[model samples]
Target: MSDSKSKRLRDPVHGLIVFAETEPLDLLAWELIDTPEFQRLRRIRQLGVSKFTFPGATHTRFAHSVGVFDNARTLTKVISREMKRNEQIFDAPRSEVAIIAALLHDLGHGPFSHTFEGVQESRGVKKRHETWTADIIRNPNGSIRGLLERYRVGFCEEVAKLLEAEDPQDIYHAVVSSSFDADRLDYLRRDKLMTGTGAGAIDFDWLIDNVRVAEIDIGAPEDDEPVNKVSTFCLASKALPAAEQFLLARYTLHQQVYFHKATRCAEHMIGKLLRSISTVANNGKNVEKMTGLRKEHPLIRFFGKNGECVENYLALDDTVIMGSLNALTAASDKTISEVADRLCNRRLYKTLDVADVGHDDGKKRQRQRTITRDFEAEIKAGSVMIDEKASISIYSEIGGDDDRTHKKLHILDGGKPVEISRLSDIIKALEKKEQFTRFYFEKEEDREKAQRKKGQNHD
Candidate 1:
């Protein structure tokens, strides 16, 4: 109850992260981590269905959150040293705001983390986790806001601003949300380690030592004259290789781990299961009796009309959802039971990369449509096409639509702030976005094979 024990955590990625219990700023992180809301993060996995593919990726957002805070703590030390020669100040108040903001940035993620948002959107509750995060932090009735306000008057707003990324060039906000910020830094390493992908090996020590506070070009968009400047973390020229490795690691991990076909299939099942729940809800049936869940169950409340408030959302996490999925295995509705059993038992859908269909894009589309139409009519399982093309590139010479955070991470060369893409061919090449289109469904051949194998094993 008291801050008697040493405020320390044994993180697998970041190692031992210790905070001085006596220091006000350190005390803030310690107290916040102990809150019920923060503790809920332990029930939420960092990678959602990633564990279905990468068995070791069962790590919680709680660990990642702590790691981000550790990164912010490390960056503050860098800020203290790097900004000493500059006009900027890394004071205690801003330092507190930065680290706390990093700690609580992913605070409002729903059940199954990011993928669950898609389910919410389909049902028309379109408010994102960020919106919920702001609501939770600013809410007078919530636990976090009171704790933040107790630290200092109006401190809640300051931390919220950092999370909102109100000022991208502000060094503190940069630490929270910049292109190469602590969130990315911690997750790249933490996810790599947890997923056991052995990808995204960055020079963590080199990056920390090399990142410096600097004023970069901010005039291209806002003014005709390239006169205005903004301050943020810029990479030292020597850390180019390290930065390149970091960027490539993100791409490789996305390809091999984050976008693993099995993981994507598992996530797809979750979305389908939620829709199936909606179907069951729409039918005039005794939902509680059919599903064997309480009238006030998280899933019921979530799918109900005018449902999914902050309190309901908070009450739902990976644990609750997993439990709900298990409960739905007993559901009487044929469609809901089928989807729920598939998810609960890990009989996930299969993926069909569009490239495999044909050499030409037209041929691929034609073959894809043929297979999709055939599968829809022929397969009892979900045979819907999951066509999606997303960019895997992590770096840019010039920032994209969300330009604020991406452009600030410059490379300092020849006493000038240059875009990192200009200095390294690797970075420049990464600027050209790469995309992939893939379809996901279950194959009858594979299903029959699995069933036959199971029968043989029993014999």
Candidate 2:
């Protein structure tokens, strides 16, 4: 590709993303972008039902992926410059692999993004989006894998390994998957911008410039033993405020955008619809035939006994799911029709925050079981059907005891490497968990009936 032939894409979040012919990796990235599998991401919503809550959050995974690739490029250039200044050997190929891994990180996200994962998990399917991503990348028949192989013999496998964190100790590996990686950096800013939530503001340029590779001793070192020093990504002491802002941005995004009550309600409706559709489809019924769907309905494979065929998975996106929902609004099965109608018409389930719900894992489960039994008893006793939906835990375990990323992150204070928590109280506070549980009802009348029964029981 010549300089004149190089492509430049304009992005609202990242300004401009360029695929310069002068850069081999950029050209390769452009090639990957042109593939069908990568292009499918344009149809998958990045924030799932968050658009219902934040109207401007109609951004797709394709845009987010592009933003991530841009962030990776910026971070890699910074790392390369610092490595040269420090007289360290910078592996250009490894950096390229990291950049490519970042580009394809969310390739496996299904329709409605993370919301689809919740539906799959409820059905006892354990594979996450990352697992699907790895499968797609390693699939010999896939265009991404073919392109990677053509670029380098084992390049596809190398990229997959990086995505799977096979080389955790490698700094290049951290560039894509770590706590402060390009994925997080891009999503925080992009999400904030797209959702119109001006809460998450981080000086990305300062953070990128201040990032340095340092030798740090992870965890609590044993006494009288030489501390093992591993080269990992860290922020300079001068960038402590920037790092704090970044962490704050992540926390705020989760609170304001990711876990919005209305969005969760909409997501719960979708989950119920999927469950109803799956149940009907599993009974040897021709849902695709009845719905008159144009595309081969990929969801049929997901609802099948085996679960999630690659061919079917590739054909799925937000459009397919939305189209299916539109068709299902008139489904012959009442449950499927009602659920789909509610979702398509935005008549989402009403959520009631249960103050009595305990936070302890075991206690929470017991409370939930008791509430469910009572709710079902009411339903069996001829009360309106009421369903319970618990919001997924919004808290992240990033800086928790089990997490070792904090140990790897060092802040150079007075020419000495120090842990970031020691410098900022805001970052330390974010380490704690914040969780809420809510119950969902099919209708306001059902909720009233349940509450009346509960009051009568107390009397």
Candidate 2, residue 269: the lDDT equals 73
lDDT of 2 by residue, 1-459 (tens): 234377899998778788887787889999888899999999998888888888899888899999899988888887788789789989999999999999999898888766677778877787778878999999877888888998998999999888876335667777786656787777788888988877756897788878887766654568987765656678888898887777777667877777777887777677767766666556546665543332246776667655567767888888888877777766666667777777777887766554444456655545545556767754453222323432322225221222564333468887676877678777676665555565677768766654454323321
Report how far residue 388 has shifted in candidate 1, in Å: 0.5
Tell me the whole-model lDDT of each prediction, alpha carbons only.
Answer: 0.74, 0.73
lDDT tens digits, residue span 1-459, model 1: 364555889989888898875677778788889888899999999898898888899999899999999898898888888767675565867877888899998898887765777777776768777777887788777788988888899999988776765545477767787766788888889888888877667889998888887777564564555555667788888988888888888778877887677777777778777777765554527877676567788777766666657776788888887887777878877656777888888887666665554456565566555555545654445555464634456552111233454443577898677877778887677675554566665565743443333212210
- Note the clash tally of each candidate: 0, 0
Model 1 global lDDT (CA atoms, 0 to 1): 0.74
In candidate 1 the C-alpha lDDT for residue 399 amounts to: 12
Best by lDDT: 1
Candidate 1 TM-score to native:
0.88
